[model samples]
Target: MKIQEIREIIKLMDQSTLDEFVFEAEGTKLKLKKHNGETRPTVHTSAQPQEQPAAVVTPKTDAPKVEAAPAEPIEKQESTSSEASSSYKTITSPMVGTFYSSSSPEADSYVKVGDRVNADTIVCIVEAMKLFNEIEAEIEGEIAEIHVKDGQLVEYGQPLFSIK
Candidate 1:
C-alpha cells in the first residue's frame, strides 16, 4: 500500500530464490517478475474492473549505447591511474535513477576517494519518481574509485563506487 511496503517486498524477492510474486489486496493487484539474471525485476499494478490497461513501472535499467562522450575521458583517466593490483568491492545502484553526489548542489559530496565508510554511511542519493533515496555503502571499506558522474542517469545494478 505504501512505498516502503513495496520496497520491502522487492527486497525480499531479490534475496529469495523465487522468480515471481503476485499479491492482491483490497481492490489493488500487484505482480512482480524478474527477467534475466542481471536485470531488475518489473512491476505491474492494476485496480479492479480491468477496463484500463495495467500500469507497468519498469526501472530504466539499460540505456541505448552511444558514441564516446566527453565524460568518458575522465573515467578513462581514473581507471588508468589506479593500481592494477588493487582489490576492491564495488557499490552498485539498487535501482535506476539520476545519481547525485550531494543532497543539494552546494553541499559537499557524501564520500570521496580515500574516505572510509561503514554499512550505514550514506554515500549518495538516487532520485526516482521525484523521490530522493539515500543509498548506503552497505560495506565497510575506504572508497577507492567512483564509476558514475554526478547527475548521470544510472542503470539498476550499475557500479557507483569501488571500495577497498
Candidate 2:
C-alpha cells in the first residue's frame, strides 16, 4: 500500500524465481509482471515524486511478434555453457542488480583474473534497490575469468566469474 512496501516487493520478486505477482487488498489491486531471460537496463528519470496508484495492465494484441533464436545458435550456447561449467566453478549473482567491482569508484577492484580466492572472499558488490550487497566467492580457487564489468546490470543466477 505504501511506496516503500511496493519497492520491497519488487526487490523480492527480482531475487526470486517467480515471473508474475499479484495482490489485492483493501480495494486496491497490485500486479507485478516481468519478462524473464530478457535483461534490460532500467533508466531512472529525475522528477518530482507523485502519489502512488495501483498498477494498470493493458493487453496489446497488435504488438509485433518476435522470432526465437535459431536452433544452431541455441545449441552452441548450451554446449559452451556446459563446457565452462564442467571445467570451472562459477560465482553467480544471487539477485538482479548493477555489478560494481569495488567498494567505490576510486578504490581498487576486489579481485582480478589470476587472483586466488577462498570461500569467504568478497569479490564484488551487487546493488539492488539502492542496497549494495557484497558478493562472495563461495569456492576456493584461482579466478579464471570475470564475466561482468562495473556498472553492468546483471540478472539473478547469472555467472559473475569463472574459477579454476
Candidate 3:
C-alpha cells in the first residue's frame, strides 16, 4: 500500500467515531491505532522535497483480516445504571470540527463538571476550518459529563455535554 493510501485511511478514521483498523493481504499487513491525543496535526520533517509531486497509484488488496474498531476508548470503564427519571438532556454538536474547551490555549475551559449552565451559555468551542464557533447550551442544567475532550474531532450531532 502506498503512503497516501495509509494516510487516507487514517483520515477516515479520524473523521468518524471509529477507532482501530486492520488490513491484511497476501504478505502485507496494516494495523492502525488511534491515540489519545486530539486530531493529528500536520507534521513536517527535514529531507522532504518542496517541489510538486507526481500522482501515485495504489494497488488493490484482497485481504480477509479480522478488523476491530472500538467506538469508544478502551480505557473508559462502563457501569450499569438503574434507569433514572429519563429527564436528562444531551447537547450535541452543530457541525463537524475540532472540539475545544477554551477560547485559547492559555484560557480556562468554558464549562466543567458540576458547572451550572443555562440556555444561551457558551459551553465550548467547535473549530471548523479557521473559525472557532462557540457552542451554547440549549437547556438548563448542571454539566453531568463531557463526552469529547479538548482538541478532539467531533462529528455533527455528536454528544458534547450531558445535562441533568
Candidate 4:
C-alpha cells in the first residue's frame, strides 16, 4: 500500500473519531487499527491483482503498560526477587507530592552521578504544598539514576531506582 493513502486514512480516522479501517483494492487488502491513542497497521495482498478497497474501524482499547526490560535479566532477578536481603536502599517519599532532585533550579542536585547513600542520607526532596520534605534512603547502595527531576510530580508508588 502507498504511504500517502495510509496517512489519509489515519487523518480520516482522527477527524471522524473512527477507531479501525480496512480496505481492499487491486487484490490488496489493508486493515488499520487505532487504540490507546496509538495506531497499528496490518496488510494482506492476494496473488491476482484486483482493486476492491474496503475499510473497517474498530473501537478504542486501553493503553499497555510501559515495556519491561528483557526477560532474561528479569528471570534471573525473579529467583532472588523474594529474598529478604535488603541490600539496596530505596529512597522513598514520606508524603504525596512533587519530587525534586535539586533544591533549586540552578543548585547542584541533592544526589548526583555516583553518590553512596544509607538510611539517613537525604537523597531528594518531595514537596507537599509549600513545605519541602526531604526524602531519605531506606537502604544502602551506590546512587543509581534519579528517576524523577526537580519539580516533577510523582505518584505515591512511582519507581525511582535501579539498585544493583
Per-prediction TM-score: 0.55, 0.53, 0.50, 0.43
Candidate 4 structure quality by residue, lDDT tens digits, 17-114? 44666666567777777777666777787899654344444545454323322212111121133432456434444445888887787888777847
Over 78-150, each residue of candidate 3 has an lDDT whose tens digit, in order, gives 2133432367678887766999999999999999989999998999988875667788897899987788889
Q: What is each predicted model's overall lDDT from 0 to 1?
A: 0.70, 0.69, 0.65, 0.60
Ranking by lDDT: 1, 2, 3, 4
- Determine the C-alpha RMSD for candidate 2 after optimal superposition of all C-alphas: 14.0
Top candidate when judged by TM-score against the true structure: 1
| Native-structure RMSD, model 1 | 13.9
Ranking of candidates on TM-score, top first: 1, 2, 3, 4
Residue 146 Cα positional deviation in candidate 4, in Å, after optimal superposition: 1.7
Model 4 is weakest, by summed lDDT over 10 consecutive residues, at: 70-79
Pick by TM-score: 3 or 4, better one: 3
Best model number under lDDT: 1
- Which candidate do you rate higher for lDDT, 3 or 4? 3
Model 4 residue 20 distance off true place after TM-score fit, in angstroms: 49
Error of 3 at 28 (Å): 44
Runs of candidate 3 with Cα error greater than 4 angstroms are 1-85
- Summarize candidate 2's per-residue lDDT along 19-89 as a digit string, tens digits: 45554434455666667532222322234432332223322245443333322211111224343567788
Error of 1 at 31 (Å): 1.3
lDDT of 3: 0.65
